[model samples]
Target: MSIENTLSEIRDINLNYLMLAQQMIREDKPSAIFRLGISKDIANLIDSLSNSQLTKLANAQMMLARFRFDDCSILNMLTSYNKDSALTNAHAVMLMANQPVEAIA
Candidate 1:
Protein backbone atom coordinates (compact mmCIF):
# COMPACT_ATOMS: atom_id res chain seq x y z
CA MET A 1 0.00 0.00 0.00
CA SER A 2 1.02 3.58 -0.53
CA ILE A 3 2.28 5.69 2.37
CA GLU A 4 -0.68 8.01 1.96
CA ASN A 5 -3.11 5.12 2.35
CA THR A 6 -1.27 3.93 5.44
CA LEU A 7 -1.38 7.39 6.95
CA SER A 8 -5.08 7.69 6.22
CA GLU A 9 -5.73 4.36 7.92
CA ILE A 10 -3.71 5.48 10.93
CA ARG A 11 -5.71 8.68 11.14
CA ASP A 12 -8.99 6.79 11.00
CA ILE A 13 -7.84 4.43 13.72
CA ASN A 14 -6.74 7.33 15.86
CA LEU A 15 -10.11 9.04 15.48
CA ASN A 16 -11.99 5.89 16.41
CA TYR A 17 -9.75 5.26 19.40
CA LEU A 18 -10.14 8.81 20.66
CA MET A 19 -13.92 8.70 20.29
CA LEU A 20 -14.18 5.40 22.14
CA ALA A 21 -11.81 6.58 24.87
CA GLN A 22 -13.79 9.73 25.43
CA GLN A 23 -17.00 7.75 25.75
CA MET A 24 -15.38 5.33 28.17
CA ILE A 25 -14.01 8.17 30.28
CA ARG A 26 -17.34 9.95 30.40
CA GLU A 27 -19.31 6.85 31.26
CA ASP A 28 -16.92 5.58 33.94
CA LYS A 29 -13.96 7.63 34.96
CA PRO A 30 -12.17 5.07 37.16
CA SER A 31 -12.71 2.13 34.83
CA ALA A 32 -11.60 4.11 31.81
CA ILE A 33 -8.45 5.25 33.62
CA PHE A 34 -7.57 1.66 34.53
CA ARG A 35 -8.50 0.21 31.14
CA LEU A 36 -6.63 2.88 29.21
CA GLY A 37 -3.62 2.63 31.54
CA ILE A 38 -3.55 6.39 31.72
CA SER A 39 -3.34 8.86 34.59
CA LYS A 40 -6.40 10.73 35.77
CA ASP A 41 -4.97 13.96 34.38
CA ILE A 42 -4.59 12.45 30.94
CA ALA A 43 -8.10 11.04 31.11
CA ASN A 44 -9.40 14.46 31.98
CA LEU A 45 -7.54 15.95 29.06
CA ILE A 46 -9.03 13.40 26.72
CA ASP A 47 -12.47 13.90 28.17
CA SER A 48 -12.27 17.64 27.69
CA LEU A 49 -11.19 17.60 24.06
CA SER A 50 -13.69 19.06 21.58
CA ASN A 51 -14.61 17.34 18.34
CA SER A 52 -12.35 19.66 16.36
CA GLN A 53 -9.51 19.04 18.77
CA LEU A 54 -10.03 15.31 18.49
CA THR A 55 -9.99 15.49 14.72
CA LYS A 56 -6.84 17.59 14.78
CA LEU A 57 -5.08 15.22 17.14
CA ALA A 58 -6.25 12.21 15.16
CA ASN A 59 -4.85 13.64 11.94
CA ALA A 60 -1.32 12.96 13.18
CA GLN A 61 0.49 10.21 11.26
CA MET A 62 1.35 8.25 14.36
CA MET A 63 -1.12 6.20 16.37
CA LEU A 64 -2.59 7.46 19.63
CA ALA A 65 -3.59 4.24 21.33
CA ARG A 66 -0.99 1.64 22.33
CA PHE A 67 -0.58 -1.71 24.00
CA ARG A 68 -0.76 -1.37 27.74
CA PHE A 69 1.15 -4.57 28.43
CA ASP A 70 4.85 -4.37 27.65
CA ASP A 71 5.69 -7.76 29.11
CA CYS A 72 5.82 -10.72 26.77
CA SER A 73 4.29 -12.96 29.38
CA ILE A 74 1.24 -10.80 29.73
CA LEU A 75 0.91 -10.47 25.97
CA ASN A 76 1.24 -14.19 25.54
CA MET A 77 -1.33 -14.92 28.19
CA LEU A 78 -3.80 -12.68 26.47
CA THR A 79 -3.19 -14.05 22.97
CA SER A 80 -2.75 -17.71 23.77
CA TYR A 81 -5.79 -19.92 23.87
CA ASN A 82 -6.47 -22.12 26.87
CA LYS A 83 -9.23 -24.47 27.94
CA ASP A 84 -9.47 -22.61 31.23
CA SER A 85 -10.10 -19.25 29.66
CA ALA A 86 -11.63 -17.67 32.72
CA LEU A 87 -8.69 -18.43 34.99
CA THR A 88 -6.17 -17.36 32.38
CA ASN A 89 -7.99 -14.06 31.81
CA ALA A 90 -8.20 -13.43 35.55
CA HIS A 91 -4.47 -14.07 35.90
CA ALA A 92 -3.72 -11.66 33.08
CA VAL A 93 -5.88 -8.96 34.65
CA MET A 94 -4.11 -9.44 37.98
CA LEU A 95 -0.73 -8.95 36.32
CA MET A 96 -1.95 -5.92 34.41
CA ALA A 97 -3.42 -4.40 37.56
CA ASN A 98 0.05 -4.36 39.07
CA GLN A 99 1.46 -2.34 36.21
CA PRO A 100 1.91 1.37 36.82
CA VAL A 101 -0.47 3.75 35.07
CA GLU A 102 0.94 6.03 32.41
CA ALA A 103 1.61 9.49 33.80
CA ILE A 104 1.62 12.71 31.80
CA ALA A 105 5.12 14.02 31.21
Candidate 2:
Protein backbone atom coordinates (compact mmCIF):
# COMPACT_ATOMS: atom_id res chain seq x y z
CA MET A 1 0.00 0.00 0.00
CA SER A 2 1.10 3.54 -0.67
CA ILE A 3 1.99 5.95 2.17
CA GLU A 4 -0.81 8.23 1.06
CA ASN A 5 -3.42 5.53 1.46
CA THR A 6 -2.09 4.50 4.82
CA LEU A 7 -2.06 8.12 6.03
CA SER A 8 -5.50 8.74 4.58
CA GLU A 9 -6.91 5.88 6.62
CA ILE A 10 -5.06 6.96 9.74
CA ARG A 11 -6.36 10.47 9.27
CA ASP A 12 -9.92 9.28 9.05
CA ILE A 13 -9.54 7.15 12.13
CA ASN A 14 -7.81 9.96 14.00
CA LEU A 15 -10.65 12.31 13.14
CA ASN A 16 -13.17 9.84 14.47
CA TYR A 17 -11.23 9.68 17.69
CA LEU A 18 -10.96 13.44 17.85
CA MET A 19 -14.69 13.81 17.49
CA LEU A 20 -15.22 11.12 20.10
CA ALA A 21 -12.90 12.97 22.43
CA GLN A 22 -14.74 16.22 21.91
CA GLN A 23 -18.05 14.58 22.60
CA MET A 24 -16.60 12.89 25.63
CA ILE A 25 -15.28 16.19 26.95
CA ARG A 26 -18.72 17.77 26.66
CA GLU A 27 -20.43 14.71 28.10
CA ASP A 28 -17.97 14.55 31.00
CA LYS A 29 -16.53 11.27 29.80
CA PRO A 30 -13.10 10.67 31.26
CA SER A 31 -12.09 8.27 28.51
CA ALA A 32 -13.12 10.76 25.81
CA ILE A 33 -10.98 13.42 27.45
CA PHE A 34 -7.88 11.37 26.62
CA ARG A 35 -9.04 10.19 23.22
CA LEU A 36 -8.27 13.26 21.14
CA GLY A 37 -5.52 12.64 18.57
CA ILE A 38 -4.54 9.59 20.59
CA SER A 39 -4.72 5.97 19.51
CA LYS A 40 -6.21 3.47 21.93
CA ASP A 41 -3.98 0.59 20.86
CA ILE A 42 -0.87 2.68 21.20
CA ALA A 43 2.22 1.43 19.39
CA ASN A 44 5.42 0.76 21.25
CA LEU A 45 7.57 3.48 19.69
CA ILE A 46 9.78 4.62 22.49
CA ASP A 47 12.59 5.91 20.27
CA SER A 48 11.07 5.54 16.86
CA LEU A 49 10.80 9.18 15.92
CA SER A 50 13.91 10.76 14.46
CA ASN A 51 15.72 13.41 16.51
CA SER A 52 14.18 16.20 14.47
CA GLN A 53 10.70 14.74 14.71
CA LEU A 54 11.06 14.24 18.42
CA THR A 55 12.17 17.84 18.97
CA LYS A 56 9.40 19.16 16.77
CA LEU A 57 6.69 17.20 18.56
CA ALA A 58 7.95 18.31 21.96
CA ASN A 59 7.99 21.95 20.91
CA ALA A 60 4.49 21.64 19.54
CA GLN A 61 3.25 20.04 22.76
CA MET A 62 4.98 22.70 24.88
CA MET A 63 3.35 25.47 22.88
CA LEU A 64 0.00 23.75 23.01
CA ALA A 65 0.14 23.43 26.80
CA ARG A 66 1.08 27.08 27.35
CA PHE A 67 -2.45 28.29 26.61
CA ARG A 68 -4.44 25.07 26.59
CA PHE A 69 -3.34 23.37 29.78
CA ASP A 70 -2.30 25.03 33.04
CA ASP A 71 1.23 23.77 32.59
CA CYS A 72 3.39 21.63 30.28
CA SER A 73 1.71 18.30 30.71
CA ILE A 74 3.01 14.92 29.53
CA LEU A 75 -0.11 12.78 29.38
CA ASN A 76 0.56 10.51 26.41
CA MET A 77 3.33 8.24 25.14
CA LEU A 78 5.01 10.82 22.89
CA THR A 79 4.53 13.63 25.38
CA SER A 80 7.16 12.86 28.00
CA TYR A 81 9.60 11.48 25.46
CA ASN A 82 9.29 14.51 23.22
CA LYS A 83 9.81 16.90 26.10
CA ASP A 84 12.81 14.94 27.36
CA SER A 85 14.32 14.73 23.87
CA ALA A 86 13.83 18.44 23.33
CA LEU A 87 15.56 19.20 26.62
CA THR A 88 18.43 16.94 25.70
CA ASN A 89 18.77 18.62 22.30
CA ALA A 90 18.86 22.03 23.96
CA HIS A 91 21.50 20.89 26.42
CA ALA A 92 23.61 19.35 23.68
CA VAL A 93 23.50 22.56 21.66
CA MET A 94 24.42 24.61 24.68
CA LEU A 95 27.33 22.34 25.50
CA MET A 96 28.53 22.46 21.90
CA ALA A 97 28.36 26.25 21.81
CA ASN A 98 30.35 26.52 25.01
CA GLN A 99 33.20 24.41 23.68
CA PRO A 100 35.95 25.59 21.34
CA VAL A 101 36.04 24.11 17.85
CA GLU A 102 39.42 22.76 16.89
CA ALA A 103 40.76 23.36 13.39
CA ILE A 104 40.97 20.25 11.22
CA ALA A 105 43.70 19.67 8.64
**RMSD (Å) per prediction:** 1.1, 18.5
TM-score of 2: 0.30
| Stretch of 10 with least lDDT, candidate 1 | 96-105
After superposition, the stretches of candidate 2 with alpha carbons farther than 4 Å from their true spots are 29-31, 34-105
Per-candidate TM-scores read 0.93, 0.30
| Model 1: per-residue Cα lDDT at residue 89 | 90
**lDDT string, candidate 2, 1-105, tens digits:** 996666566555544433444455556434432423232222113124444543444432112221122223322322445647867656544543344422212
* Model 1 Cα lDDT, one tens digit per residue, 1-105: 999999999999999999999999999999999888889999999999999999999998898888878899998998899999889999999999898988755
Candidate 1 vs. truth: CA RMSD? Answer: 1.1
Model 2 residue 12 lDDT score: 53
lDDT of 2: 0.39
Q: List the residue pairs that clash in candidate 1.
A: none
